[model samples]
Target: MTTLPTLTLRDGLTMPQLGFGVFQVPDDQAQQAVESALEAGYRSIDTAMIYGNEHGVGRALAASGIAREDLFVTTKLWIDDHGRGAARPALEASLERLGLASVDLYLIHWPAPATDVYLQTWQGFEDLRAAGLTRGIGVSNFLPEHLDRVVGLGGAVPAVNQIELHPALQNRETVAANAALGIATEAWSPLAQGAVLGEAPVVEAAAAHGVSAAQVVLRWHLQHGNIVIPKSVTPARIAANLDVLDFTLSEAEMAAIDALDRGQRTGPHPAEFNG
Candidate 1:
């Protein structure tokens, strides 16, 4: 089994650069998929309360027999739970569903600027971190403006900001902002939900490396220093996604894929969401 490379967070915690994501994974299949991923050498698992499969994920983790200390579990608090009052209970519920005493990382799932309470929510996360319920805390789908507000208000800076990033939507501005703030950038749709796998750059790179187009894209993300969580229910794909560390993409090829960014997003915009 290939050992995935690790990225260091601002707070000095190490995260597996490539992890398994359980977004859109059906409730019934989530456990089996996660078990397969763990058996395939995945130590990091990304789930959320909104995904509605944290229980399944918990089952898989318990069944894997891997020590809790060896696993890095990450879960998110949903938009509806984005306030100081709602934050702690939401995290507790997530921990209950995950069947874990504490999560390695906790995140505010979305900023939902219309609600305008991330500061309070962040304070809740800070409280959770201080209480030792979560090893580290962060946010997701937050924009540059959100980051600025958090910093300007003297709130806790997130260790990471998970977002919709792929070859089609690189989010250069967000990347720069996070880099400046020492926040690690996580790529949620690193493979574009498999939408960009057929692009010429990806396909050609795959052929050159004798690997799948999906691997090429994932490798591209790794080279760019984005924490990538590419999801797959198939055993072979799940195993293959973690086999990216042995190969490297050239600068020219990386540049070609970099040019493929069109600034399009498949998910919702953070600004207009109310919850």
Candidate 2:
């Protein structure tokens, strides 16, 4: 099994650069999928309270017999739970569902600017970390403005910013902002739901490397230094996603994929969404 590379977060924690994501995976099915991923050498698992599959993830973790210290579990607080008193309980509920004492990382799932409470939610995250409920805290789908506000609060800066990033949606501005603020950038929907896999750059690179187009894209993300989580239910696909550690993409190859960005987004826009 290939050991995935690790990222040093600003919070002084090491995170697996490539992890497994359970976004749309149903609650009942998440256990099997996550078990396959762990069996395939995945140590990091990204889930959310809104996903409603934390219990299934907990089952897989327990059944795998992997030591608690060896796993890095990250769950998010949903938009509905973005406030002072709400975040702590939301994470407590998540921990109960995950059957764990504390999560490695907890994130504000979305900024939801209309709600005007993410600032409070972020502050609450700091408190959770102090209480040992989470090892680190971050935000997902947050824009540059949201990040600025979070930083302006004079609290702990976020550890990472997980966003919708793929070949078609590079999110360069936010990525640069994260770097400027010393926050690692994590990418969800890394392959664009297989929407960009068939592109000429991805397909050609796959053929050149004798790997799948998905692997090429994953490699591109890795070279760009983005923490990427690619989700798959199939056992073979789950394993294949982790196989990216064996190969490297050239600067030209990386540039070719970089040219494929078209500002496309598969998820909701961060600014307009309140829930």
Candidate 3:
């Protein structure tokens, strides 16, 4: 099994820098996909309530034969589960669905800026962390404004902030803000949903490094110090994604990819996602 590099969160929790994501995966197929990923040396699994595949993921984890301490499992609290009263039960439900005693990380799935309830949702996460139900609690799809509110609470802080990030949507401001507060940033849609896999810069970098374009993109995230969860159902791709730690990209090559940023987005704006 290949060993991926690890990153430490704000609360001193360490996570594999590269993990497997189960987005858009069907409920029935999640188990098989996760099984393949585990065999390919992925110890971290990222899922969400909205994904509706936690049960299948749980089944795979149960059968992985890997000890509980050896794995890092993360699930999110969906928009509907936001606020003080709803967050605890939702997390318990997620654990029930995952068939785990506790999740390594739990996140607020969205800011839901229109609803203005994320502050209360974050409070719930703080409570969960205090109670030890979740090792670490954080938020996803949160911009600087949302994060600032959490910080203002004073009792607890977000350990990680998962968000959509790729060459197209660099999120430099958010990254800076997270760094400033000692919060770790994790990248979802790290490959831009495969949109830039064939781009000239990424292809050239991959060719020079003797790796795949997908690996090149993932390496970019690692080099930038962001935790990344890249999803692939294909066995070869799953193995290939974890094979990036063996090589290094030159500063010039990394710069080329950085310059390719257009500020274009492949997902919905965080502020606009009501759900």
Candidate 4:
């Protein structure tokens, strides 16, 4: 098994920098996908209430025989569960499905600013942490404005901020803000849905490093200090994604990939998405 690098959250909790993600994976297939990822040396698992696959994830975790302390499990609170009262039960239900007493990290799936209830949702997260239901709290798809409001609360700060980040959409402003606030930046869809895999920079880096284009992109993310969760159902690809630790990208190569940023986004804009 690979000895993956770990990042410490602001609250002092540590998790593998490169983890497994289960997005768009059917509930029935999540178990096998996650199991394959575990067999490939992944100890962290990221899922969401909206994914509707926590039960399968739980089954795989239980069957893995990997001790709870060795695993980092994260699940999200959906837009529908965006309120003081709604957040706790939402995570409780997720814990139920995941068959765990508590999750390692629980995040608000999106800001859903139009709904105007994330503040309350965040409070609920804090309460859960105090109650020991989750080890840490965070928000996903949150822009600076949303993060500002939560930070302004000055009660409990977020430990991580997961967002749609990749070579095509670097999300520099958000990344900078997260760094300024001492929050870890987590990259979802880190491969740009395979959109930037064939680009010249990625291809050239892959050729130079004797790796695949996907591995080049993932390596770029890791080198940039961003936590990434790449998802793949194919067994070989899952193993390959975790095999990026053996190589390094030169400074020029890193700059070339950085220049590939054109503000392209594969998902809905954070401020515009109400749900």
Give the TM-scores of the predictions, in the order they appear.
0.98, 0.99, 0.98, 0.99
Instruction: List the global CA lDDT of all models.
Output: 0.92, 0.94, 0.91, 0.95
Which 10-residue window in model 4 sums to the lowest lDDT? 80-89
Task: Kindly report the root-mean-square deviation of model 1 from the true structure over all alpha carbons.
Answer: 0.9
Off by over 4 Å in 1: none
Tell me the tens digit of each residue's lDDT in model 2 across 194-217. 999999989999999999999999
- Top candidate (lDDT): 4
lDDT of 3 by residue, 11-117 (tens): 89999999999999998999999999999999999999899999999999999999999999999999888789999999999999999989999999899999998
Relative to the unseen true structure, what is the C-alpha lDDT of residue 148 in candidate 4, on a scale of 0 to 100? 93
* Candidate 3 regions with alpha-carbon error over 4 angstroms: none
lDDT at residue 224 of model 4 (Cα atoms): 93
Q: State, as a TM-score between 0 and 1, how close model 3 is to the true structure.
A: 0.98
Q: Least lDDT summed over 10 consecutive residues: which range in candidate 2?
A: 244-253
Please state every model's RMSD to the true fold in angstroms. 0.9, 0.6, 0.9, 0.5
Per-candidate clashes come to: 0, 0, 0, 0
Return the lDDT, model 4, position 111: 92
Pitting candidate 2 against candidate 4, the one with the higher lDDT is: 4
Return the number of clashes found in candidate 3.
Answer: 0
